[model samples]
Target: MHRCTLSKEKLAAQPGGEWTHSVSAGFLKTLGCLELLSVVGLILPAVLDIAPVMVPVTAVCWVLLLTGAMITRGRLGQVKLVAGDAAYFAIAVFVAYGRFVIEPFSS
Candidate 1:
């Protein structure tokens, strides 16, 4: 929400804000909204026991999002940042794998 709602100046004032310069505000806002929805999809359905299958699906979406982030960071020559994104991508992949294979939620 912060990234979607904050003014460009305010966003640029944040930590690691320099990366914001590499992308348009619209892109940032859209990414922020998608990320927010992904977080909800990851947690809410499982916790509420309504549609726990969404957990793995959302994790897959998160993996895709992080892949884009890694590519963007890599293009920007931010190798260190790409490593962080890769770490997150790995975690998302793990979650997806665990939910889809190891202990899947049955509908």
Candidate 2:
């Protein structure tokens, strides 16, 4: 018995086709959104200090997003991207943890 394999041609032709488009678009959008949120969360809180809560919230979200990114990239079968993404993700998590635990919020 032989298992079905996706060919480069098949994968490429329909990439951004039906389900592919939606899933890819959603994931990419989510990634971009998370980065933006992370920045806004870290900076806005430190500068505005409005809620001062935004920092932790954003940091957590960043770590979460990176987790998703790492998973998605892994499933998508991109090794180089996965490695880079995971490394960055680790950094993000560390920063988040640092903000929440170590540095925390200060007046």
Q: Tell me model 2's lDDT, rounded to 2 decimals.
A: 0.63
For model 1 the local lDDT of residue 103 reads: 92
Q: Residue 39 error for model 2, in Å?
A: 1.9
For model 2, residues 1-107, the per-residue Cα lDDT tens digits are: 10123433343355322323434544544555556667877788778768786776776777777676667667777677778878877777777788778987775
Q: What's the TM-score of each model vs. the native?
A: 0.85, 0.64
- Model 1 pairs whose backbones collide: none
lDDT of 1 at 100: 99
Question: What ranges in model 1 sit over 4 Å off?
Answer: 13-19
Off by over 4 Å in 2: 1-31
Backbone clashes in model 1: 0
lDDT of 2 at 99: 74
